[model samples]
Target: MTSPRINSVSIMHYTRPYIELARLEKPTGSLLIFWPFEAWGLTMAAFRTHLPLKYYIPNLLRYLAAAIIIRSCGCTVNDIVDRNIDGNVSRTKKRPLPSGRISVRSALLFLVVQYLVGIVFFVAFLEGLALRTALWQLIPM
Candidate 1:
């Protein structure tokens, strides 16, 4: 089957290299981002019998959200930066940047929006009580 263009893919995204790139291509970035929080929650429960971690759950959620957004942001940035190079390589020659499926301007604007979400996540983290709970890592297993 012929590869679909990026513009059409957004309507109902699925398995594709660009989207997969957004998902970080099986890298451990998202895991690394989320595991510490889950571990902290469980370990604290193990160590401190009474410190309820319900408060930290929101931040855990935020961390997961950030992982996904940041990974997607990284993917967009990669495609943006590598547009010309991707156009040259046969494997990537049909990617959005080369095939005119998505424009450079739109790609850049989308990236800016994603980074803004990162800023919001950071700001929320700073002001959130959920953050305080995560910092107090429990005793090592």
Candidate 2:
């Protein structure tokens, strides 16, 4: 029988491609998406309303989560759409899709799952104007 460590290693190996496809290793994209918009907005709101730490911290985390979801979903879609072009570019040629590490069908399925998670997160954690704005962001993706 395989050891637990071996199983975990195998799982990581399996997920490596998907992780690359989402560009999770390089978090600059997600941070860029978050800080410019969400972080500043949250900071402004907290300052204006004297929002408590309890509420402020959790909402900040939710916004970060949303940023990650949006960035990953956008990357996956971009890679899928630019698979052929990416293969020709020196910098992007080794990406998951272009490198043959992942299939288009698999990427599509992953994209769908990402959207579902985003929707569930927005619905579960946000309400009123926040919820409406979050849902609207998904329209372009």
Candidate 3:
């Protein structure tokens, strides 16, 4: 019992850096990305079409998940790209990459993993043009 508890705590400690790297602590970014594009659009469409609760609720959940993943990916890319500049900045100096809590190589791997998950999610839950459009959104303009 003691050993398992210690291990779980250790795992959480190890993941802290990655979580910060992905900006999971601050969810405003995710919500900002979600509401304007996904949430409102879906809500209006469901209202107009009289879509059933079963479909609307599940789709909303999926969009929420996508928003989180997409925001995480964007933050990781920003941190990786601005690592050097961030180290010299006052506000961003303590970020994971700048603070040396996470290596660039590790961050890149994490970013790739995020993109893969996003792709798999869109492909699995969406179809045809919807799938293509969702996948296209994953690529930065």
Candidate 4:
């Protein structure tokens, strides 16, 4: 018999619980986390210097993506940290980690992926000292 072959579709299907663990399915959480951060950053940047529409727009989009990823990481970390406590709570007992649908190790791996994507975007979008500094920010998160 041939060994199982995993493809992008299958991987994506399997990753659903982790995605839920990240709270991506719930728009409220991600929006609440990203919107203010994005608004503050854009307001500050726009206030500090006059950037052409072409430049600020792309950067704004990139920052939004970064914020979403960061928010997801925060949610995953919360779930992992609270897994035990969550198991004890009737409301949270059904969550991915507490429900035994997702392992702590798997959740951690998913968090790493989220971090890597955010780091890649920051490094690729920024320049020089900014690139180095941005990469450093990703390490802790």
Candidate 5:
């Protein structure tokens, strides 16, 4: 049978569950992954130069947004890649992908869009740098 049409209400209803599946609802998981990046980036920037604190606020926001998007995309890709296993596993059987709350194509498209957005924020780091240096980080993407 063809897949049923997914509507706004359906999406809203599953939003909380989806966040759990993506681990956004879990603070420890996010902290464990993002703390190192934040510490290193801030320490490196501070160690590299002695500037005013306000100067780094914007950069901090850009990096935070980038990290959240990148992590969310990774979770989305994982769910898509492991749909079969998740469906069979007791732990993830109720997840968005396995429970028919999300589609595979939707997951891939979300990842692509999130990654593109993440790259755009990455360019903020290369703001004062040459174009050549920025190109290297993008080749893998």
Candidate 6:
């Protein structure tokens, strides 16, 4: 059996690059995008009559989660598209994609997984709230 130090080192080696890949290490960009949209959505949602804190609070938390997922997705896509460009820039050269920490294909796969997980979370939250759109409204005439 592997020792604990070796196990932890292997885990960090495998997983640490993804933190930079997802932009979690620098969250100001995500927060900038998350807070304003969240504020606007919460404000609009609050305008509805009789929205108790019990209802609003859970939804608020879900929205926050969604914002973080979306921001991560945006960061991933940007990294994918700008990998070559980022390599040329001093500030971004050490990013996961540009720095050879992760392969392009692996980064793309990670992005797809992130999107699927985000979709699952969204569907679960909506299902929990019984939110739905009628089939008729979705059909084009």
Clashes of each: 0, 0, 0, 0, 0, 0
Give TM per candidate. Answer: 0.57, 0.91, 0.91, 0.74, 0.68, 0.78
Q: Which ten residues in a row have the lowest lDDT in candidate 5?
A: 130-139
Candidate order by lDDT, decreasing, is 3, 2, 4, 6, 5, 1
lDDT, candidates in the order shown = 0.63, 0.90, 0.91, 0.79, 0.66, 0.76
For TM-score, candidate 3 versus 6, the one ahead is 3
Off by over 4 Å in 5: 1-11, 14-22, 124-141
| lDDT of each residue in 1-141, candidate 2, tens digit only | 965565778888789989999889999999998998999999999999999999999889989999998888888889999999999999999998999988999999999998899899999988999899887777654
Question: Which ranges in model 1 have alpha carbons more than 4 Å from their true place?
Answer: 1-10, 13-21, 24-29, 36-51, 127-141
Candidate closest to the true structure, highest lDDT: 3
**Local accuracy of candidate 3 as per-residue lDDT tens digits, 51-119:** 999999999999999999888888998999999999999999999899998899999999999899999
> In lDDT terms, how accurate is model 2?
0.90
The order of the candidates by TM-score, greatest first, is 3, 2, 6, 4, 5, 1
- Candidate 3 minimal-lDDT segment of 10 residues: 1-10
Per residue, candidate 4 scores C-alpha lDDT tens digits across 29-100 of 667755686757786888689878888777777767766776777788889889999999998998899999
With candidate 4 superimposed using the best TM-score fit, by how many Å does residue 6's alpha carbon deviate from the native? 9.7
Clashes (candidate 1): 0
lDDT of 3 at 71: 86
Query: Tens digits of per-residue lDDT for model 1 on 1-141?
Result: 999767765754533544444555655766775568554654576457654567556545666775566556766777888888988899888776677766789777766776676666656665556544333211111
Q: What lDDT score goes with residue 9 in model 6?
A: 80
Instruction: Report the lDDT of model 1 for residue 52.
Output: 51
Ten residues in sequence with the least summed lDDT for candidate 1:
132-141
**Residue lDDT tens for model 6, 1-141:** 965566778888888888888888788876786578775768677877667888888877777776677777778888899999999999999999999999999998998888777767766776533333211211223
lDDT of 3 at 15: 93
